[model samples]
Target: MTENGAQLFARLETRPCLKDIEPQLFPEGGGPNHGEVVELYGTEGTGKTEMLYHLLCRCVLPVATGGLEVDVVFVDTDYSLDMLRLVSILESRLNAGSSSSAESDEAALRLCLSRLLVVHCSSSSQLLLTLHFLETSLSSRPGLALLLIDSISAFYWLDRCEGGASAIRQEEKLRKCAELLGRLLSDYRITVFTTCHAIKKVYNGPSSGSGYDRPYLCRPWQRLVTHRLLCSRQETNSVAPSAGGSEEQSRRQVFTVHCTSSGSRTKAYRSSSFCVTDGGVKFI
Candidate 1:
């Protein structure tokens, strides 16, 4: 049976992390609806992966404890999934309880981590194969809500270098990957968050002549991105209080702007401010 918009909305899962950071990013204060693809693009060290980990923590945590309590599939292409960092954030959330029993806190943390499944893919071929294997898992696990790829363009330069004289061959592989992702979105009913690199400037180099940066990905992948979050770090001298000593002040403020396109018009919500700390992403 085919479901209409209301039926689909009823079935859609909630993402507490997005709500916490920026409720305006989603329609009617709901987080990314089912089958939506979001791309988080930025230059290096813009807290992109950290933001993803925060979202992952929120997905796996219990709904009773202010989380969605759903399963997550994290594809770490850059091999940057910091288990320790994720655990720290999870622990902070658990400990913030109002005199909750110690055993309950420990149990909740265990349950949250258990629901998360991380897969590491070092090469583009491995990433493709990993997604293929995930099909069976996705079908079997109804609790799964999100599939996250840390830096979808992890192999972009590598693929280009290997292609040598033929850009067509390089693009062909990327097109196949995008097709698979689109199929997964339609077939599995899951929200996706993938990170992309900015192409307008070198990592942290000064902005070019026009001083604009854009998300860089193949056309096929671009088509799959329904919503785009542009992340950037702004240099700042202001100090933010830290859980640790004052020595750990915030060095930079991170901004994320949510953009969605309809027909030929594009609408972007105001940017949100956050800072990365040892604990996790702190919205400011």
Candidate 2:
């Protein structure tokens, strides 16, 4: 049975796109759409995971609180997910909204947390299995709109060592993972967000060689990425006037996120700066 054009357009209207997650990061207002993959790559401590948390929060919160109110499946391969940190940020976001009683806030927090499904994977094989499991889970839950995998390159060196001199064997597991991900995207209307660590040193001058910062992942995984975000961090000094008429010097870390899209249409490259505070990521 083929659907008519009117029915197809109606179905498209109901699909969710994350263009409003962070306008500052995606100034063009074209965020990750359904069945699309977005990759974030950077060195450690550059706030890649923190950005994931922010995006996850946006998906899980209710519509009344300015969130998408959709379910999220978060696959944690690096074992770096801090539930306490996520809860703290969620609490702050909830509190910043309309004032309510403590009981109501707690209930809202629980409701938001309920929308998230967290799975931990210790190895590449486990990660692959997890994706298979997610297919069944997504089928039962129509509200699941986002899938997050923190640091998909967590097992890069391990696979390399195990493969020895065979390049084909080295990328075998991830290649399969990429294939499975593509199938999942085709079967479901969900968006994927994964992180890749920067393996090579970053150079800033024009003399830098070509392919210096190219992604080290296999072609299968790289080909699935529709948006690539390069993250970097820098430290800056801030001086404030104290009540006692003395100057106070403090240092703060700032993260710069630049995004490039590789789709049918051209999009202007955009970048934004932000700082990670106790509350969450505050864009500047």
Best candidate per TM-score, number? Answer: 2
Candidate 2 C-alpha lDDT tens digits along 17-92: 7766678877656887778899998889999999999999989988887789988999999999999999999999
TM-score of 2: 0.92
- TM-scores for all candidates: the values are 0.82, 0.92
Best by lDDT: 2
For candidate 1, write residues 194-223 as lDDT tens digits: 888766644555654433356556788888
lDDT for 152 in candidate 2 is 96
Q: Model 2 clash pairs?
A: none
Q: In angstroms, how far off is 49's CA in candidate 2?
A: 0.5
- The local distance difference test score of model 2 is 0.87
User: Candidate 1, which segments miss by more than 4 Å at Cα?
Assistant: 1-27, 201-212, 239-266
